[model samples]
Each structure stands twice: as structure tokens, then as C-alpha cells.
Target: MEQLARLEDLPQTYIDHLTQSNLVPLWPSLRNVLPPKQPVPLTKATAWHYRDIKPLLLEAGELTPIEKAERRVLVLANPGHGLENMKATSSIYLGMQLLLPNEWAPSHRHTPNAVRLVVEGKGAFTTVEGQKCIMEHGDLILTPSGLWHEHGHDGDEPVIWLDVLDLPLVYYMEASYVEGGDVQQVQGTDLGHHYAKGVVPTVHFVRQNANFPLLRYAWTDTKNVLDALAADANHQAPAQVSFINPETGQDCQNIIGYSAIRVAPNETVQLTRRSAAQIFHVIEGQLSITVNSDHFDLARSDTACASCFAQIDLINRSEQPAYVFVADEAPLQKKLGLYSTRPRSV
Candidate 1:
């Protein structure tokens, strides 16, 4: 391997001439962009504990009312990305959003696809497009791109949900923007029941829906699926299921891929390192997460993030099985032909 030239070694007059012409050399900074073996990711192995965050999040609610704060949230910022950037990974934006009793986050839609993994409380619901999706302890709700959505809480307790969005990628492409709208009159019940077993209504005229037909994925149903997968006597593979569009069978969203993974008691599952940055949020029992060399002991509502090509291992050292909700940038990377595992052979 040869050493690359440094920008500081360049002649001052040449630098000034290039700067004046709005041009610069790539050789001096080539490795910064195209590194030796793997990507030099700004994202690092990071974890956000729910215990430390709940108090601050509640304080945010008391300090700022719903009217003043459209969405009361505390961003889970990764230090590698810089706290100011508010990014959990290279492409994902994570925030713990709160909606107090009788409070409503006004109706608005944005260009970036967003999903909410319900963390606590029950009386909160998010209306996306026209369906009213009730928020439960572990429900996964979608508010895809360009869709009208609003959050409202009917119960007395404070409701909090982890919001996952592709804001950084959309904002980078200059396509991220939001539009405010009047309060939504939630039209129908969530579409989850209709496709409960992946069965489309045949006798009745199925309501024609837009790109997103089913928005709410109940955790009970997802956990059941994972249990069934684990019970299989045929294979010993990782018990995981991808969240997909019921209609077209594609990824639930265009940019990010979401999944639910179950680790049986006293098991250690090595999640393969891929070309997409990933996040894992604990939904059930405890998990000991390892991202490369860093280890994170996660409880309910705790989250861990790993950059691309970083080794991740999830361990369930307890007596009960552990369930995790996962999100990654694979959809976008695959679409752009930049997704892959680390090469095994040199």
C-alpha cells in the first residue's frame, strides 16, 4: 500500500488558485471518502437507556406544552454523528416522543418515512392517512412518506413511543419537508385485522388503499410469529421476521427495513454485519448487546445502534426469551446497489 498525499503538503498558491476556481484535488482526501477496506462511518456503537431518559422526557413535557411543542421528543443522538446532528445512525433519526393525556400533536405529514415503536402507556394513538392505529405497549405503527398523521392520547398516563425516521437521508437529498393540516377525523379502524393472516378480503369489495394498506403491526401477533418460528423443528436459524407491505410484499417502507427478532433463553445470536447501519430496541426481556467491542445491557425500551460492517451479538442470559425490534438502512442501500456483507476472502 502506498501513502496518499496530504492536503497540507499542497502549495499555498495552488490551493488559493483551486479555491478561487471552485475546484480542489481529490487525491489528498480520497481515503477520507473511500477508505482502505470498509466504510469510515460517522455512526458508532451507541446505546440509549430508557431509565435515564424517562425523567428528562417527562421534564420536557412539563416545560413545553403540546401547543408550544408540536412533538415533545428527546432525540437519541449518537456521539460519533455529533449530538447536534440528532442522528442515531448514518441514515436514521431516533427520538423518544411523549404525548400527555388529552394532548394532541397537530396533523402534519413529511417526506421522510417514519415509524413509532410504542414504549409505554396505552391510551395514545396515531392516525395515519385515514386509519386510527391504537398505540399499545409494543405495537409498531407506520407513518410513511407524504402521509397525513397526528398523535393523540386519551388515557391519563404519560405515553411515550420511540420514533424512527429516515430524516437524515431525506434531508441530505433535499427532499425532507413537512406540511401542516387541520385535525384529522380518523376514518376507519386500523387495517391490521383485515390482513391478520395475510388473507385479503375476497367476498367484499376491499377498500382500495394507497401505497400503505396496513399500518399497524401488533406486537402480540409478531411475537406469536416469532414463537412459531422458534418452535420449528426443521431449522436452527435465527428467529426473525421482516415487516413487509401486505399488498406488494415489499419492504414496509422504501428506505428502511424493519424486523422483529426473538432470542430464546440463554442464547447468543450473532447478527451478521451488513452494509447497512442498524438499530435494535428491546421490546421484551433483557438483552446483552455487543457491537464490535462494545457491550450494552439493555432492558425494556433500551436501544442500541451499530454502524455498517460492525459485528453485533444479542445475548439472552435470562430465564425468559427476549424480543427486539430492529431497523436498518438496507432497503435504500440495496436499491442503490451499495449493500453487502463484509467480504470473506481478500
Candidate 2:
């Protein structure tokens, strides 16, 4: 090859001439540097989402002492998304969060994919798609991605959760539209009672003997399913088990990516990095997570544990077990309908 060189011996004139001819054309133009072109403001009212807390997580002693009663978040997208310059979807993604004791974000929803996870709150709620669900902590509540949903505090304490929407997704598609519900919110108690009254109730899906598939999952029932897995001889999962729609047997929440949980509990889970970058949020307990030796001490509402295709280890130090929510494309893209665990190739 050509001899190795250093800049010290090069003449100033030669360096200047070389840089001008080689670099200026690569500089971004004024148009590229300017902000995105603002389209004509739509006449329809645009809704808003909030992330500031009624009380900071560091404020209260009890909330911070045991690390309970606080709303901590890893992601929040509204009014903007991280990759705004790359895509143009009207959908906006939000990671709404709340902690305990009187910190209610109030009732509101718009024509966007609004989804929430009851991170660590009891008696929190969302009335959506004309149905109501009491969001117990760890419950994945869906507002039909675009139906009317509102969050509130009815119990004695505060509740916090993550609210994710697809506004940016829509913005990229350039097919975003907005329309408000005729009624801002429906009564939660009424919806709750209406569902409870029916015996062997089946509203969304018909109940077959083995495949009564309407509800994606109930945490208690899933726990039992996991218990069965534990009883099995080969329960390593090396991969994780995902929730599937029983009727169609497809993954739930089409655009939300795929949701899966790993029960390694102080073990290592290998993953391959690809185009799909995920934001993993811890749902319960504490963990010592290391993404290739870049360690993260994560607990409930603490979102320090995330990586894309790096070898990750979760070490639990708490007396109780830990649960984590990982978002990634189903069946690793490289494997195509399968989870992949291979080392990165240089």
C-alpha cells in the first residue's frame, strides 16, 4: 500500500487545497440544516401529552427509600420523535409515566396509538374502545392504539405507567388523521360491572374449549403458565416465550412490535443486533443488568437496562424476582420467525 503519512510534514497550502476540493461538497446544505418543512397546520384540534411529574421521584423519602411510589420513565415521545429527520409519520410515540400518591395525569386521548403499561401503580385505569380496565401495576393496557382513553387516580395513592403512541409512525407514513370521540370518556365503573356480570363471558372472541382467545393474557394466568413451564424438564427458554393471540394465534399489538419476557434470573440472554432497536423497560423488582460490561442497576420504573444485539446479563439482587419488558421484532430478522443468539462479527 502507500506509505503511512502524518499531517505534520504537509505544506499548509497543499493541505488547504486538498481540504477545499475534498470536503466542501460533503458539507450539509442550508436546506438540510434548516428545520423540517412545516406543512399547513391542520384545522382539526391537535391533542397534547405530558411527562412532567406532580412530584419528582426524588422528593418523597418513602418513594425513594424503598424505591416505591414513583413514576420513572425511560422514554417519552410527543410533539416529536427521535428519528424525525429520517421519517415522516404523523403518529407520535409517548412513554407516559406516573408515580404514587396523588399524581394523576388526568383523562385524555386522541387519534393516535395510545398504549400504557401500569409500571408500578395500583388502582390506575384507562377507559378505552368503550371498555374499561383497572390497570393494576404490570398490566399492559391497550387503548385500541387509537380509541378514547384517560388515566386517573381513584385510589388513595398515586399510580404511574408508560404511554406509547404511534404519532411519529403516522407522521412518517404521511397518512395521519385525527378525530375526537363523541364522549370524552365513558364511566369506568359501568364498563367494569358490565363485563363482570356475564358468566363465561365472551365479547371479543368466541370461547373454544382449548383456544378461548380474546384476552391476550391475564398476569395471574400467565404466572400459572410459567409455573407449568418451570415444571418441565427443559425450561431454559434460552429464548423467551411471547404472548400470542389464541384465536388467530398471532402476536398482539401489530405495530407495537413484539413483547417478550425472559426469566433467566441472574443468567445471561444472548441476542443479535439488527435494524430494530428496542427500548426495554423493567416492570418489576430490581436487577443488575450488563450490556457487554456496560452495567445498569435497574429497578421498578428504572429504565437503565437496554441494548441492541449485545450479550446481556441480568443479575437480581433483590429478595423478590424481577420482570423486564423487551421490545423487538419477532423471531429475529436474520432468523426470520426465530429468535437468534449469535456473537457480533467484526
Candidate 3:
């Protein structure tokens, strides 16, 4: 009778404390405090929902506040391991970054795939998979999952780029692993020695020589590919290039996926109908993006998004030429027939 009364009274105290504090109170019988019921662990697996990033729109001929902010490479998200602001499982994780002159971010590596889209400035380089690639303005450099890479600014001006990774999935799986690079940098400053010297030969998966795994994509010849695609009438998608396995011509990674973005001067592109949420970083010039009805101006180092394909529209305002980096999980979402975009009424 005493135990039964205590059980009823103990719950009453817990409930009273919960209502008063608006938080879950611990029971003396438990080893640790219990979290709120809303965040309780699920018995069966549940599908995670997509989240959108609010966009920051920039004006024509205007620079982002980061210029005056006087810092290099602002981190958009780094909320611990499991609590990262962006999801890495169901979709790709994209981050906006700006690096001023003379700044160097140390070398590091992790399990998720990553890429950098140079937004502005020059003289910044990322060494990936042993290859050093000068992250020129408008260049896209990829760091494959489990590759060691680092960023350094040796240029005269600040360099900004978007950091996209498959962080959410790794975080959710709780398989997060990280490590520092083997050295400060390779012996050479150029970003070519890692693979050109035959030290790193292509790995073979089958007799077909298919699916060559590579980690770097330099901008030196990428622009030419964009030009060729622009000249081809059959190719309508902007920057519609896929990261292929160098050996097999297969995708570099599976699941969390890819995007193609190349903006013309003062051009605004409308997406067709996409369902996977995407994060966009303004690579060059200034951009005004309208998702559904709301809009935001984004300059270099600024980010915007269309949550799970909630209707996306983009307009470039810079004069010199503009580029944008878009990250999405279309590879997975499209497989489920959930990736598409409808033009929102202007």
C-alpha cells in the first residue's frame, strides 16, 4: 500500500514540476534526468523531415557585410556532432564561408563527402586526396568522403566559398569520426602533385575500368566545359555536370547527392519542381533568390535555400559575372520521385 501510494504521489510530483518548470523533472528512481517526452527515442525508425535555411539577399553593386565584418570564413553551422544545424542523412549539408587574406584553416578529414564552390577572391587553395587545387573564383573543388583536406589563403584579397558536406547523415548515424591531416601541407604549393606523379593510381572495381574514385575538380578546365554546354542547344540545364567516378564514370558517392549551377550575368533562373530541400551559396557576384513568395539577397558567403523544393527562383545582380553553388539530395530524392520544382508566380 505504501509503494502504491508512493508511485501515485511520485508521478504527481513529476507532473507538478513539469507543469511549473515547463521542463521534465528527474525521478529519484532513474539514474539520470529524463528529457522531455516530445524528444523521446522512437521504437520504430521514423523518417526525418527536411528543414529550410533562411536566405540573405544582397543588392546590386553591393557587397556583403562580411567585407566590413573584417573576419575570414564565417562558420554558418557547427552545432556539436549530433546537433548540427543542417541534416546530413536525408539531404546534403551546405555551409557559407568567407576567408580573408592571410588566413589558413588547418587540415582535417572526416567521413562525409565535401565540396567547395569558390564564391569570390583568389589565392585560396584546398588540398584534397593529396592533390592541391587553387580554389579560384567560380571553381568547384571536391573533397571525397574520408579524404584529408585543408584550406589556406595566400592571395592578396579575401576568398569566400561555400562548404557543402554530407554531415547530417553522419551525425544522425552517430558514426561521426574526425582527424587532423598528416602534415601541414604537401611539399609543393601547386595543387597537382598528389595524382600527377603516379603516386596515386586509379583504383579498380571491375574489368570495365569503371568508377574511378577521385577527389579534386579544378576550375582551370571547368569553365570550358560550361562554355561548351552553353553552346550546345541540346544542353539546357545550367552547369549540368555530374561528379563521376574517374574509373567507371559512376557517381563519386552514393545517396546524399549532386547539383549543377552556372549563372549568366544578371540572369535569373527558375527551377522546374524539386522536392528535396537544398542549400545555395552565392559563389560569385550578388544574387536575389525568391522561394515561393519570400525573397532574400545573397552575396558571396551568403546562403539561401528552398526547403524540400518549396519553389525556388534566382536572380543575379553582379556585373562581372555570377555563380551559385546548390546542394541537394536529388540522387536519393529523385529515386523516390520526390524531387521537382514548380515555378512560383512572379
Candidate 4:
């Protein structure tokens, strides 16, 4: 009788109602699921040394061909997150791909926007929708969502580049799709030949398709732009330039943001914390980036990543100017009304 009375005292009506409706009340789990504040940031400040990864990349190249491997890429997986997911940060995916001379990475297109920042070698080209854009060290190339593209290397040395993609966003939205193209390599005539002849083959493609107006942001032009910006005597901490869509004059991709930041010799730039995560690749000289309270010194060809909502500061300790290629998830965050930044105290 005592046990029966205890059981009767329990909220049997509420339990029966919840089970019939297939709904679980939040009262018990609310504290665990919805906290007063963000439990913790999803990413960590991490850096990768090219010297350490180069040999491993080379070994991967020897072990598998481009076709077998699909793409010879070594992902810069974040320690905070595990490698099984292949993410550099919670919002961005970063990888280093190597293409040997005379090799080809087959044609395929996906719904996620991607950008490549060339790190080493030259004479490689990525053909997007029949327009070939030559790849050189320090160049930034774009392959927007659903754009057919293929990569091939004709240079004497192996060409390597950092591949940044909005894969996490696509995955989160469940909009990821990949379709392979029929052609393996761009046919007989190298489009690069036309480029060498001072002809822009992309003009016709750009006119035909308004979606992909730009394919390649050449390093020479980018350097010139940076130089022009730096020429101003009152130029500020980090001289920066963004890659924009030729048609919209907006970010290169609708979902991703790309920029080049130049830090003059012996200069330190204190950057505010933002709600979007960013991955940066060091192009030249030496740089020390302080994220939150942690510091990372990046050398030439090194890469570093910062988590969302963390204050960052960049310092150039070398005699020569330092350049960094940055890719971030700001565009999507801004579009969704989730973008924010707080100024850091000097």
C-alpha cells in the first residue's frame, strides 16, 4: 500500500500525455541543451608547418595516383574537432593538394563553393567551364558552386595549393551534391596558350554565364592592388584587399569570403573578434598571430586557423612585408543575421 501510494503520487497523466504525443518535455534536459551562455567555442587556434607536411604529402602522392586518390589532398584537420570529419575549423574545410607534372584531377562539380590559394610550383591550370586559368604561386582561384572544373599540371615541378571550401555550411544545410563530368582533361589545345597570347578566354564564358563571371584572381594583379593600397602614406595596420565577383562586385562566392592581408615590416595589427571563423595561409615573410591569449608564429608557406568569436592580432616580425591569404565564413553568417564583431581593447 505504501509503494502504491508513492507511485500514484507521480505525474502519471503528464508522462502518458508526453508518450502519446511523441514529445519530450524540455524541463529535465533544458539546462544541458540550452545553457545561459555558449558552452564553449567549437574550434581552436592551430597552425601547420609546410616543412612538416611536405614529406607526408609527397609520400601520399607516391602511394596513390590522382585518379586512384581522386584528389591528392591532406586535410588540415583541427585538433579541437577530430580528423574523421576533415574540418580545419567548425565552419571551414582546409586542405593542401598536390598535383604532379602531367597529372590530372578529374572533372567534377559540387554545390559547395571552393577557393584555392597556390602555395608552391607553377605551370598548373584549373579549367572552369572551358575557360582555363593558369595557376602560379600566390594566386587565388575560385570555383563557385555547381561550376564544372578540372585541374591539370604541366609544370616541371609538383604544384601544391591550399584548398578552402564551405563544406560545413553545405553539410549543415544538406545541400551538398557532386556530379562528375564526361571529359577527363581539357582537349588538344591548351587554353593557357591563348592566355599566353594575351587573350582572356574567360570573357566569352563570363558573358554566357552570369553566375561565374570570374574564375581566377591573378597574383600579379592582386599584388598590384595591394601595392597601390599600401602606397597611401596613412595606410593602416594591415593593408588588405578582397577578391570580388566581376558581375556583382561582391565577395568571390556567395557563401565564402576571400581576402589578402599584407602586414608591413615590424607592424602589428590588432583585429577584433568576429562571429565567423577564418583560415589564413602565410604567403611570404614571417608572421606571429595572437588569437585570444594564445600566440602562433607562422613562417612562409605555413597555415593557421582561428575559431569564431575570438580576438586576433597579427604581427610581422620580418624585415620584408608579409602577405596572408584569408578565407572565412562571414558572408553566410552576415546573410543569416548571425554576424557580429567586438572591438578589441588596445
lDDT of 4: 0.81
- Model 3 vs. true fold: TM: 0.61
Instruction: Report, for every candidate in turn, its global Cα lDDT versus the true structure.
Output: 0.91, 0.48, 0.56, 0.81
**Which digits, one per residue and each the tens of the lDDT, describe model 3 over residues 1-346?**
1222333566676778777987753444333234432212111111111112222212211354433532233335423214335543244565556665665666778887777777667888877655567887667677766667777778887565667777666777787788875545464443333343225444442221123244455554555666577668898756556655444455556655554566767777777655566666554466778766677776655665555535667777666555555566776656677556555554
Better of 2 and 3 by TM-score: 3
The positional error of residue 112 in candidate 2, measured at the CA in angstroms, is 3.7
Give per-model TM-scores.
Answer: 0.96, 0.60, 0.61, 0.86
Q: Residue-wise lDDT of candidate 2 within 20-138, one digit each (tens)? A: 88843322333344424322221111112221332453244244532342224434432222333321122224454654444443344454454576655576665554455677766
For residues 270-336, could you state the per-residue lDDT of candidate 4 as single tens digits?
7777878888889878899999888998998999988877889899878888888888889888999
Error of 2 at 103 (Å): 8.9
lDDT of 4 at 212: 57
How are the candidates ranked when ordered by TM-score, highest leading?
1, 4, 3, 2
Clashing pairs in 4: none
Model 4: how far residue 253 lies from native, Å: 0.3
After superposition of all CA atoms, the RMSD between model 3 and the true structure is 10.6
Q: Which of 3 and 4 is the better model by TM-score? A: 4
| Total clashing pairs for each candidate | 0, 26, 31, 0
Query: Could you give the C-alpha RMSD of every candidate to the true structure, in order shown?
Result: 1.7, 11.1, 10.6, 6.0
Candidate 1's residue-wise lDDT over 1-346, tens digit each?
A: 5898998999999999999999989999888888988888989899999999999999999999999999999999999989999999879999999999999999999999999999999899999877899999989999988889999999999999999999999998999899999988868989787785657656463544557877999999999999999999885769999999887789999999999999999999987779999999999999899888899999999999999988888999999999999999999999999999964221
